[model samples]
Target: MTEALLNVVGVSRSFSAGEDELTVLKEINLQINRGEMVAIIGASGSGKSTLMNILGCLDKPNKGHYFINGQDTSAMDENELAALRREYFGFIFQRYHLLGDLTALGNVEVPALYANEGPHERQKKATQLLTRLGLSDRLEHKPNQLSGGQQQRVSVARALINGGDVILADEPTGALDSTSGEEMMKLLRELHRDGHTIILVTHDPHIAEFADRVIEIKDGEIKDGEIIGDTRNDNVNAYQSSDRAATELVDNPPQTHPQTAKQQTTKYRINWSRYLEALKMALIGMSNNRLRTFLTMLGIIIGIASVVSVVALGAGSQQSIMANIASMGTNTIEIKPGTGRGDRRSGRIRTLMAADADALKTLSFVDSVTPTVRANVAIRYASETVTGSVQGVGTDYFRVRGYSLAQGQFFAEGNALGSVIFLGHLPVRVIGVTEPIESVSSNSDELNVWLPYTTVSGRIFRQNYVSDITVRVDENVESEVAEQGIISLLTMRHGTVDFFTINTDTIRKSIEKTSATMTMLISAIAFISLLVGGIGVMNIMLVSVTERTREIGIRIAVGARQTDIMRQFLIEAVLVCFCGGALGIGLAYFVGVIFSYSGSDFQMVYSGTSIIAAFACSTLIGVLFGYLPARNAARLNPIDALSRD
Candidate 1:
């Protein structure tokens, strides 16, 4: 004899309620034949729904063995049971537990996706099924947009998408009007005629009259394990009369053949099609709630923009400071009379003199030495009188200080003792005379006047002392070693080390280091904002998981593994963060450009590495913060999730 399609032996199920065990089903022994329409009927609070759930592999039986085609279901794991539901059983929920995020056509393709069906095949099959159910015009409508009867039809189409032989519907028409209910019953009858086994649970006795067999269940026990009420003798006769056709239909189900069957045998372990479908759904969900999505992304955008801009500004500041230092020559040292200390007595030193400058120039690595004498003198240029510094220097001042002559020439060697002087810190025409060095600054520009050392000591200051001296060392020599030599020489010449001070490349490096540290501090503060943004993302994702509990349940019902649901939410979060990060990068550059053009001293340098790092970090933040919410969603109990409002 052929084995029964579904067999239940002494099945019982219970729940713990207030320290008392309430049994829902007890010793339910039943057998459903292939291609038979069996209805399990009972009043309110009866165990008919529980029996249907167990039959559908949606819930486990506590004390029984359920066999599907002689294979015991009790030994199967959750994944295997999900496969059985995906490949062999189709459920039609009473409330039409459709995914609100998916349209009718997408909903119908769900089971096929889990079965690893190709997109074209699933689409074609879903289209045909939806059209056959008279929902072709409503294929793109979401659940909330559809009427009760239309939704019921969509659910029916979903149940048949995987070519399942067993249709376990729990109160399929319980929520519909009479006319819609009658239409639903007729569709089930047609499916039964087409060689599908229909196990329906209902409370309506009239509805049970149409089935080939009705098993009445009260409380947790079956009243009679046989056909009752309306016998449907004519329907039984028709089934018997068409037994040969039914057998043929069962052997070769609709829209399937030898090649398709052979292809089905090679089940794909990883269903990328489901992932693609999930991504599409996630995008749709985000788009539908545009305001919330944007609000959620705002934190990341601001944080990344702040960080990128700070880093860019810091880089620009370092470059600018180094450039300013390079203008004075990296191998140059400045020797001022005072020690670099915050004391007035230490600054009043007249130890550095013209002889010291000549002595320094005689060193092996020293290229040039220019002793400076500063006088606050007033110059009159064509009715303009300005008071500024008139500097006395040697002829090699330009080469030593990295300054350039935009127009006029420097003083000749013969003019060293001559009265001829190159004027700076004054207007181009002084007393109807044109002077050089007017292009570099808007205020008092320094004028270079070359004079013999003896002439400057006697003529300008009437003293033999110089305020400061600059030494240009050869590029091949170490400036630090030269600095030590200059200090030792000055100490010996002055007879006291506290009387003079010298610096070589140390001031520029100190400035660069200080600027860098400031920049890092700013960047660190920006990262704190990024951390705040990550926390915001976590909160928003948790709220999203809570809001979509029902939708999560529907996906699980359609054969979505926990990982699938987890991945879907994770993708949504990452997509939001990536988009925000991209926008932040754009904003950073835009603001940088504005600041650069706005004549601010703070310039921004956009680095390729910084942009890439910012975006990568933002994506990582999404993943790190989104995991908890995704895990919460994945670990949800499908039964409880479905019941959530």
Candidate 2:
């Protein structure tokens, strides 16, 4: 007895129809032997197509069992069913069902792609199949570019790509003209002659005549309720009676055995080839919808740019501020009369004096010291009288303040007491002008006059005590340690703490802390935009999945695994975000260039770490937002997806 290649025993399929169950097929029993060309004829809505789908593993029956070559299909999982579809069966749809974006050869190679065939091998086989089907000149033509007959030929070629042990064709000639339909039937007969079990589903009686045995189905049940064919019969006589020319054309048809094709389904630990193919598909999808892809990336671009630019701006501003602070002299301390600035009696507590400066200079930790006395005065220089601040200081004041001379020299040790500018009523000679200091407290427009404390205290204010003292600490000592020493020495000398000291180092630390806090707060706010962008990606990808439902169906029908479908969409999403990240990084650098040209005191300083982090963040957003859409696409029912308009 001949073994049945495909067997269906007591199978029933039902669908939900608005609270009522609609049974499409009931108690269906059939058995198809190898190398037999059988035609299943039925009218529209007769469930013949559903039966074909079930037989091809595209749909499962709600009840009973289906077996393929003694292996029960009811026991197979989705992947296993997919493997069966890929290795054992090939479908030729009534509508041709070719992917519009792919060429004739490309469409033919899809099944082999899922079968884990190498690109070179699949392409060669696809080319050979198409050429043998009389489409040698149309290998690169897309489906839309071909005639009905040419497309059907390409569909036939695709069906044979993976050995196609059992060919389940659903109204394969329904869409073609009489001449094309005849050609397609003739081609099917040729395939049937080459040891293939061909199951043809059609409504036309004339088409049924081409099959060796005709099985008529009506209202989801076999006519007369029998299996309809003999247990075993030789199909050689049937092939010999076919048209001689068509059989001669496929005399040496590609010999791909079902068992050999089945062995190819044993996959590797990581199918890098499938991933690479998915990546290629992702690029093609992105290229085909350039505008939509870019629009989807817009939010990510703006978010990444904002985050990187804001961080760079914060870093740059902080650097500029620190530089200005450094101009005021590093590790410097100021001593002023009174306990603090808010003290009401600070002006009257004039215990801080020149002696304190001299005493601080004597300490090992003190690098230099200057006693300062200030008086606002009017000075006449060449008949131009300007009100200015006159500061009295020791000769080392300019050096301790980190001031460099612009044009004039500072006071000599001997001339400190002799040369001075004559203020409103005091007699003083103009000696020298120091360079402009770039400290935070120094204003470029403010006129400053410096003189010896001996001259200012004796000739002008006539006060024995200095207004304040400035001490530059040695580089070897920490500022806080030097501050403690100065406080203790001053307390002992004065018998009490009558003055307050301001450490520049402490001010630097506080300013740095504040700048960092503000940066983090702003960066966090910018990060919100990234989250919004990720949501946008998810929304767009969901819409894309809906739009490409038919495409997904086609891939699944052509033996694609759920993982394969998910991987392609996921890769596309990730590519969009990654490209957006690259563009965003470029935009940030461009913004930096624009900022530099604006003549600002500071330049934007980009960090390598921040740029890398931004790139990683964009990629993460892609994966996080893309998974939902990919999963939804992967989980779509193939039959429903194909039925969707």
Candidate 3:
């Protein structure tokens, strides 16, 4: 008189085996009314599991239609199928299908987690259900710590968590011992009497007799379909074994609001509580295998540390170079002559003259111009005969080159141009030292001998050619404008621009550019290591997915969408990498401090951008590489994963 809760018509299923097709279920039809206890009995490979898969909507029938609660399921999408499972069906596997990482209470709360229940409500319901199942004292025990009978009881409580009315049991008592199996059958019968529709698959006729109806399948076809009367003559009795517990469970019954609870859960969206719970479960999963988790994260840590350290060192080198350049003065420029254009044999340009120097001084932004002529000569200062290069320059050379005198006054201009050649090759004499010079070979001014331009040109070398010119630019004038003026005047005087080179704004910029380029190059090289780290992450995550196939299946059967599975795994990967990045930054900082305090010339520089970039890249690496494994996990067939050993 009432509509059947589930209906199947002309349903069939098949699989491809290399070159041939294998049909698992052929021309099968069945119907299950509400509150009816039905048994599907068959031998192995009889297509009973396939039919059950179709009935539970975990798989689709190839050539027929199936309807649940009067709605055809053949045309439904994945989201709708997931919703259907959550709203209507509950599953209990023979192996219990409990997540090993979660506690007994946590396992019972899983379906409710997907239901978007509040934490308090979910935990309360889980506690109540466990207490009813006689697992109150063992609520915190993990699956591996529980006995076979206790695990099955936990699965029963999980099935009923979302207020699902139909229970699909596939060989629920197959793995248990005689006593445990008997107790499980008694629990199923009690559930059936309490207005729950039960469909069980088993090969034992004794198990089938406990149901109100039995359908026997053989060779992918139904061979016998019979309705059995309840004789109530079985020795298995749940009431006798645990009468007090059964009475309490019946009275409380896990509080179902009937249509309203299912409706609310169906319309539910995931919130922070569910995400936090997933994270908590993932952490627990990782913590159980601590060594493996650390091994998986090691690659990421090394990669991040390498990147940060290299960049910091580069930044420090750049800073040191810039500081040295600043000490040489930013507003100074040096000019030199290029070699003869077509003839490389003439390396010196002898055309520079004093008249050209006078022309450069007339430029608007030119502060001072000094013509230089260098010649190595031996100076006999008492007993110390120091061989050094003498620079022929003017009084403005001291101001233009940022040189300060440590002792003795500079020679006046009157004696500078006097053509008095002192015998014994006294070309020029060292008048002062700029800073405390260490030795003649050190980079200092101790060996430098300065003399006036006119004296060296007319008296010492006996020639009028100048070697090079130095120009000091005004603070207000741009270097480009001043350089162009100098180049134009010198080219006009010489009638050729190729004979000379003009430099302005010192060598600081070139050296800075070189340091920056080197930093980028090292960082790029380090990035390769990061990419390798990413590959390592993907490899380990793939292995993890394979190792936890059964757990993934358990989540799917309880109404987790593909997105839910993807989100969980993605979060796990990001958490690992982000944490690794933080640790790497800390390591680098520690290394930097040690280097700075060791009294060495090497300095480690810390850049906020470098650390931030490393952090962001770590998270990005997780997303990029974690995708393949998460996708593989999400796309797995629920039935295949559930059946995985």
Best by TM-score: 2
What would the TM-score be for candidate 3 when compared with the true structure? 0.75
The number of clashing residue pairs in each candidate reads 3, 2, 0
Better of 1 and 2 by lDDT: 2
- Using lDDT, rank the candidates from best to worst: 2, 1, 3
Candidate 3 error regions (>4 Å): 220-275, 328-331, 334-433, 436-446, 449-506, 597-599
Model 1 has an lDDT value of 0.77
Tens-place lDDT digits, model 1, residues 1-645:
676778999998888999998887778888877878888988777778778878887788899899987778999877777777787778898999887878999889988887778889999999999999998899899999999999999999999998767888889889999999999999998998887888889998788867888787765344422223333334453342245543443344334246565465553334555668667877998998899899888889999999999999898888877666655555578777666756586446677788888888889998888887766666555466566566667656666666665444565522222122223332232111123332221222554334344555666667878767888877677788888899989888888875444554776667878998899899999999988998998999999899889888777777777777888998888888998899889889899889978997658888999999999999998899989999999888777788898
Residue 610 alpha-carbon offset, candidate 2, angstroms:
2.2
What TM-scores do the predictions have? 0.77, 0.82, 0.75
What is each predicted model's overall lDDT from 0 to 1?
0.77, 0.84, 0.77
Give the per-residue lDDT of model 3 (tens digit) for 1-645. 756778888887889999998888777777777777788887888888888888888899888899876778988888778876765778988889999888999998888887778878989999998898899999999999999999999999999887657789999999999999999998988887766778899999889878877787877333322212223324433222223332232223233366677666655534565668667776887788777778777778888988999988988877776545544555666666664335463345677787777888888798888888778877666566767777789778776766556655566622333233332465344445554432212357546667788887878888887877888888678787787878788788888864544453646567778888888888888889888888898899899999999889888888888877887887778777887788878888888998889886669888899899999999999888888988988888999999898
* lDDT (tens digit, per residue) of candidate 2 on 188-263: 8888887777899998988888888777777634442223333223342564223334323223322456655445
Q: What is the C-alpha RMSD of each candidate to the true structure, in Å?
A: 7.1, 6.1, 7.6
By TM-score, is 1 or 2 better? 2
